[model samples]
Target chain A: MAAHRKRTKGTVVVDTVGIVGLGLIGGSLARRLAQRGIRVVAWNHRPHPYAQAEADGIFCKSTLAELMTAEPDVLVLCNPLKAMPAILAELKPLLDEHPATTLTDVGSVKGMVRNQVKAAGLADKYVGAHPMAGNELSGWQAADPGLYDDALWAVTVDEPTDYRRFFAVASLITEGVGNRIIVLDDETHDKAAAMISHMPHVVSTALINELTANPDRNVAAALAAGCWRDMTRVALTDPDRTRAMVEEDALNVEVLLRRMASRLTDMADQLHAEQDQGSIVRGGSLKGDAAAHIRKFFAAGDPFRRYKAQTSSAGDFPARELEIPEAGWQQTLLFSARRGEAITSFIHPHQAVIQIRPAI
Target chain B: MAAHRKRTKGTVVVDTVGIVGLGLIGGSLARRLAQRGIRVVAWNHRPHPYAQAEADGIFCKSTLAELMTAEPDVLVLCNPLKAMPAILAELKPLLDEHPATTLTDVGSVKGMVRNQVKAAGLADKYVGAHPMAGNELSGWQAADPGLYDDALWAVTVDEPTDYRRFFAVASLITEGVGNRIIVLDDETHDKAAAMISHMPHVVSTALINELTANPDRNVAAALAAGCWRDMTRVALTDPDRTRAMVEEDALNVEVLLRRMASRLTDMADQLHAEQDQGSIVRGGSLKGDAAAHIRKFFAAGDPFRRYKAQTSSAGDFPARELEIPEAGWQQTLLFSARRGEAITSFIHPHQAVIQIRPAI
Candidate 1:
């Protein structure tokens, strides 16, 4: 252990960091760590980014063996998912040589990786992490010191794993990199990822394929409205990176796609049945409850969407100075439905904690 | 027609305009027409927006027959799809009684509407129109006089239909309402709408459905991250309006979904076979060309998306000031290497039309 090694977050200290596969996440971590006066020795497959990183004053190593010899306190694996196992195997020797050096991976998928590391009896030294961050852009050029800020990083661990080891790795990444730490089992993480990241990526990529699948590719492209741009933002990532992420969790995505297919089929059937009954037409269309089923189907998710918009819609929240004015003076009560269901009120001259529900 | 009627949009002219269905589109149109000093009479199924429109100083009529009695030069139907036909039927005797009145609809799906008008022998007085405009919100409060600005208003008509009549309607919308006119036939318009508007809506709704389908709705919502919000923006429309629009084109959306389903199935199969071969590991993963198929699938529409971004992305253009003074001293020079093509060189005191094809 180096004398410069100071506790960064809850029981986690690292003076020398070894960053492998220095692309966006690795490079970003390196940049932030170096800024915080921690030593980062790096290696990237491509020699150009390696040169750039070296020029930026990082100690660039040519090989993983050489990087391990730098006596790092921790190693961060930022390699593509498919390449992680081999990288981990290469790292096995270093772990044997330096038993104190711990490890973690930033791959999106974790179940198989956790299993592999667990089988290797290295679960004591490892925790699987995925920071839900990054723009559509990737690679070293896209790396930012603030990349992981305000993002949720899932710290996945199996049962019977070393909780202390998990906390050490998780705290370093979450507190050091400024991500909110969420503890989830590997399988739970994968299911959630399938819904949020992997499934959406599938839909986006499939959407592009569907539009271009027709000979009307150019015509369809002409009709690419506002919605298409935002929806396909995820599909614009580095091809190799996308493939690696999607490939690691293909089966789960397949199940998700099948489920989505069944839903679409059901909606289509409902629609066809209504149309066959000639209810999509004018005369008695309103009187008939044809659109009721479809509307109900859509309205189920309305609250969730509204809740997200009220809280998560981008932009600065409206700020202004409000006057409470002399405490004893009477003032009209004001409250938003969004603020709370009820408010604490004091009656006439008696200061009682009375909860008053808003009439609105 | 009132003698105060002036020629608008080169041919189309109106003094009094009846804006039926005073929702976002109708209210916005009324606002714009009133601003142009035209007499704007309005009718809505609801009383609130009608009162609001009247308060906003547009002549608010109570019934369709009352709106007809006002003897407007043109009638704009801004009702939802299912309601449009009934509204149009209500305007029928008026159409016959006042032979000079022209009618146009702003409903999304146009084929059935156009056919119905043609079958009713009102094609000469009618042209189907849909403005590719609107924010996420609907209704009078969301209406803006600038709603149709920069949006394409598709003017759809059938064969043996009045080309002059179509232009009269198209020009009124494009020039009067400030929408860019795109003259597409009813079928072409429907197909384009299916690809652009209808299918995307279905997919948005379906995506939210898929994510929230399980008991893990909250979990799915928490993991919603980034892509979920943008991808599901369109699914947040008024449920009834969404149902009407989607149901009108459900068969087409079903077809589109099936196409999407097939492509998704094919991609899943490819991923599965690649995984089953154990080639998803480091040894042969990249070497096995597993990701190549997936990458190719995503890359097909990248150019189209990129091209659209380059053109449609609204922002200030890269501007630079060039000093071209004392024009007689003109020069033409050449730069070479455009990859296996010819090159031409010319430098002169007087510049002529110089064309150069460079070679590499």
Candidate 2:
């Protein structure tokens, strides 16, 4: 194993990576890994992308058995989440035959995928990861290695998770794929994913729905500018895809939506009160309870604004090493993530080089 | 007046235009008009930009009295909305002296500006125009002539608005600036502005505020991608500026925010019910009241999605002439705008060449 491993500044823990489903995300990953001089073996549901993928220096396999013959250190399930149960069932026996290969997946919802893996009796070999990448485009035709450039991934682990398996997957992301990562439990990953992506997609959809229902929709559409365009961009994508993603993480999205709805309602009340007391207010300043509340609402996000400004102005964030404690190492990395530290690479199994980024 | 106007394909109704407050919108308009060979006279609160503007062939005036002395066909008040009352007060006596100079402003909210113009006894000379252009940038230094390229201007009018004044401003937008015009009444303009821009700005701010208040904020921020960035872009701008914009159209914004809140809440309920019935549902095909409601919500915006697709694919929208009726001309043009027609040029005061755009 040591003789087969290649050495960069840090040891390349994942010398060979196997990828399933050569769609946008998977295809892009395969090409990127191959570009990075890592041996990549890929299999798609259909062989259409195989010829083009092989042309990019990736080894194309016809079956799961053949892919397993290559002895990939990390096998990524990049198939659609709907295909999870069937694929997991098929991979169960093959993975059992080669127990040394650590399993991982690039599914957006972590807990559900973990559950599926558990149901397939492959929990011991699995580590969950979701790259914060992709665009409005899909399919092998739209795949590009640049899609993973400067991407951050959330690596999910749990209490019963094997440290060796976790190290293998984390090192693959940080060193093999040359991407940053933050450790999280399945719940934290799914909830955070819901907060940032799924909930926002639903909100965007609601906005377009509101516009479509308006009597003067054409007038509103004509007057739409940067704000309207940016806020509703995600809604303009394939609704069926968005609907599936939202439904997959339905519980987390539901909670965030209610919170967002409450926030909007509170703002509406403040605005209403301000209008009612319009006669008393002078200039642009309102002098009432509603005015104070509105001022507070606007000021609440100042920390985030300042953090973004700092990040934009300060190029190349400062880096430091995080020592992963032997006991409860998952909690240590999660706490580091909460402090806005992103693990760039593993110097060794117990040590990680993290970049300290501006926090909200 | 006819002899002073320059002739292209259509009569340039406003040849010599007076501009006050040369900020982003004002400076861009001044430059674009000057580029088109229109005589532009400008007065700023300060003369910092005057030299460069003069080099661009704009006649810089030292005072409102001097700007009025230019005897411009149209006077555009482009100062900040906060300075509007003071500027209107100063312009009132000067405008009375030269009653032929039609007054207009590039304000976001038409109703409020109209009221300010009415308060100064200049409503009879006023027409409300809001160019659907601008960026996150501000000031004269950030201004460029190309900002007006392929832009839309909402020309707002009321029952008592003089035909010639409205025509002068509309023609100035359509002919002088070479842009499109959609005629609307003050209420409709304010409501639609709130719907597409103002209300969405608040929702975006709320989103950032929510993330800021989250316990796993750093985690979510780390996982943030295109959707989070796009939805929160407006919120990252000067909150004070966004607040002012929202407050100016307080009533309209309040109503729309409440509507958005209700929509979000409805979606939340559907998602919750869908999750509750997850056990009974097979494969991603949900069955229940929740499933039906969810499907309906996702499908509601299909018209808008289809309209966007059509507009993006079709190059160069079809154009035709629309004749204006003497009685209820305001309603006639409003109806034309409702039908998704944008006035490109006025062949005459009573006739407009409108482009047929895709509608929801």
Candidate 3:
């Protein structure tokens, strides 16, 4: 495996993609890439998904050994978080045989795999990517070819990413498979994943359980408002998949839950203190800094929403047909040219907004 | 006020409606009722909403006293929660004189107003109503004429309600305005409101605040999914209005928040213990009752969502233009018959579902 790293190329674009674990993410990506006329071979331990993919025109490599025999240019380990290291070990023989094969994974957390790969001295051959796109639904049955459409794919790599091969393979999946890309390191990716998806997922499930467990379950259901529905939508997620995510990200999730509990405790205490002081308390009795803090806290989510609207809204500029005003190359350049992600112009039309996304 | 409750009437139907507040709920109801050829007069402290409603062809009353001078058949207290009792006190003298007027209100909580009115011995003169419909937006600018259409209007009354007058006024607002009706007592209504609206509102704001306060806000925002948007929509609410709702429902909200926090704590503990046990956990590590509880917890919300689809979804039975099959009378009877809130049939579709809701 160590010797394999030395046999590198200038720029490598994977012709064949070998994906292990044909769940929603893997199956969906396989379908998308295969639709784009790329050769995609997948290996799943279960015969059902493998047979299903084969029937769906996906090349079926019966096992990891068979996948290695095909000499795929890129190998994606899409197995559960706990299973990646073992899969990497199984693929090591293949890596030693074909040094040109770039290794990557589509896992929620990156630190685990990155650390394992680095420790195994296979760092140069590995890249980690996560597509920030999913629904509460799960498995091959729920897979959609356009799942990654306009989705954000974060590629986690070392500071000096392997521009020649490793990064190139990840970019093929990120860009060629049709997604916007952002680059960061493993720790940042894990922390961000914890905040954005993993922990929020737990909170959502807990919120659901709490409300549903209440004595007023029937009443709560009857008055289920839009916000409540949206907040708890993820609660309807497939139990098996949610279990995987929770178990894998348990530590990060616990940290997050504790953090949230701490915040809630402080809030409850503040309200209680206000009540005790006869301060004519409301729901939350903060007249100054605490109120400001809460406001600021809520305001923080706005940027992300705005950013999503800019990137993922219908007829996103890149996909739209703008009548190039005959003399409009100037205006087109004004909008199409990356003015450092001017999100406002896109949302507010008076600003001559250009619907543009910065390059990865 | 006590003498006002003794006014005898063979039958009562409010031909004219006087609404005391002209914000979203009040204005929307006023416009809807007025559109149905019913006379409506609205009075608000703010001249803007008042002027706007008047200009919109709604009869404008200068004040509650002026509204009483008009000799309206029914009066709706559409004022804020904190102000409803005082307004009731202000209108007491008028209530004593205008014995024929049936008084009702559209407030989230029923206990406060109902109790205060009962204390004044004006119980028979008052009925409490809350329409389970709203958006994050507030004020007259956001009001829609069809806001009540396809909504659930919960009408709260005493155990021995004045069916002739009370039901007539409530029926006018619910059935005539094209909404489904549910009847409950003041305490029951308050408890249910806490379970559904108030606490969920706080949780939404808190969830937004928690996720935003994370150091990974930019990333979290970038990865935010539809659930995140729906969950946090309430975060964009007007501060003053939210403050009012929270203050008004503080005690109930505290109870709900504590319950949610309790469930969250148990979850965190279980996950922590599971991680400690290293039982090869997945999303959540509960193998016995803990696991069953979670599954049941998530399952409880499904019935509500299904019930909402049955009652609130478009063309929801009543709102639909069902071409009555000459032979479809039986199914229609099975559906439209007052069989006591057969929520199961709409959800399961297999049940012979009596469309019955219990009469007060």
- Separate DockQ for every predicted complex: 0.20, 0.75, 0.22
Give chain A TM for each model in order. Answer: 0.77, 0.96, 0.73
| Best-performing candidate as measured by TM-score | 2
What lDDT does each candidate get?
0.64, 0.90, 0.63
Q: What CAPRI class is candidate 2? A: medium
Which rank order by DockQ, best down to worst?
A: 2, 3, 1
iRMSD, per candidate, in listed order: 6.7, 1.4, 5.8
Q: List the RMSD of every prediction in angstroms.
A: 13.2, 2.7, 10.7
Per residue, candidate 1 scores C-alpha lDDT tens digits across B1-360 of 232133122243556788887788888888987876778888889878766677677998778888888988778888776575567667777789988778888888788888677666677788777776777777888888887665656566655555445545645663456444444566666766777677777778888777656544544554557778778877876656676777777777767767777777777777777777666655344445555776676677665556556655636333221221232111101111111111111111121112121110
Candidate 2's C-alpha runs over 4 A off are: A1-10, A279-284, B1-10, B279-284
Weakest 10 consecutive residues, lDDT, candidate 1 chain B? B332-341
Candidates 1 and 2: which is better by lDDT?
Answer: 2
Model 3, runs deviating above 4 Å: A1-12, A44-58, A80-90, A113-124, A139-141, A158-165, A277-360, B1-12, B46-57, B82-86, B115-124, B159-165, B281-360
C-alpha lDDT (0 to 100) for residue A234 of candidate 2: 97
Question: Candidate 2, residues A328-350: lDDT per residue as tens digits?
Answer: 99999999999999998777788
Candidate 3, lDDT over the whole model: 0.63
